[model samples]
Target: MFAALSAIGAFIKIPIGINSAALDTVPALISAAFLPPVYAGAASLIGHLSSSLYAGFPLGPLHLIIAVEMFLILFVFTKLHQAGRNVWKWIFFIVANSVLATLPFYWIISPAFFVMALPGITIATVLNAGIAIVVSPVVERVMERVRTHA
Candidate 1:
C-alpha cells in the first residue's frame, strides 16, 4: 500500500539539478513510524526506482545506487523511530538523504551540481519528514481502531 502511494508520488516531482525532489519519501517516512524497518525500506526503494523510471533514468545506472541508499537510509530511519529518538531520526534523515545521498553524485556530476541541489534536497527532506511526522499519529490512531475492530 505504501509502495503504491510512493509510485504515485513519483509523477509529482520538483526538478533539482540532475535529480528531483518528490513526496515519494513521505510514505516511507510515515510507514517507518509503525512498520518494520525492512518494510519501510522496501517502500523507499520502490519510491526511488519509480521516480527514476518516470524521469527516464536521467542518471542512468546511478539511480540504482540511489535506490540502495534510500533503502538503507529508511532502514536506519525506522530503527531511530523505534528507538524513540525523534530528533535524531529527523537529523539522520536530513543528513543521510539531503547531504550524504548527494555527495556521491557531487563527485560524479560536479561540485556545482551538488551546491545547486543541496537547498532543494533539504527543502524536500523537511517537507517529506514534516508531513510524515504530522500524519503518522493520525494514521496510527486509525490503524489502532481498525485493528481493534478486526
Candidate 2:
C-alpha cells in the first residue's frame, strides 16, 4: 500500500517554478497519521528512494537526504497529532520541512543537474511548503473520513 501510494505520488507533480516542484503529500501524510512514526518514516524514506531511483534522479546521497527530510516531517506530524494539535501544527510542519529539507538541495545540489542558478533555499522551501500546506488538509480530511467509515 505504501509503495503504491508513493509511486502514484511520484507521477503527480505540480510544477511551481524552476525552484519549487510539488508532489502530492497525501501518502506521506496518511502514513504519518495512521502508522507509528518510525514505521511511517521508514516507509516514506524507502518509498521516496525507490521513486527517485526509478525516475532516474540522482540517487545515493540525495536519497539519504530526502529520507532524512521525510523522516523529520513524518515524525513531527505524528508527534503533533498525538499532542492534539493537528491543523496548525501540520502547517508549521509543512513549512519547516519544506524549507529545511529542500533548500539545501536546490541551492547546493541541483546545480549539478543543470547549469542554472537555483532559487534561494528560503524561496524554494516556502513555495514547496506552501503547496503542501494547501493540499494536505484536504487530503487529511478525506483520509479521516475513509478511516472512520472503514
Q: Which window of ten consecutive residues has the lowest lDDT sum in model 1? A: 14-23
* Model 1 residue 131 distance off true place after TM-score fit, in angstroms: 1.3
lDDT of 1 by residue, 1-150 (tens): 998888888778876666567889989998886789999999999999998898898779988999999999999999999999989999999899989998997899999888987889888888888888898889989999999999
**Each candidate: RMSD to true structure?**
1.8, 4.6
Off by over 4 Å in 1: 15-20
Which is the leading candidate under TM-score? Answer: 1
lDDT score for residue 17 of model 2: 53
Which candidate number has the best lDDT? 1
lDDT of 1: 0.89
Lowest summed-lDDT stretch of 10 residues in model 2? 113-122
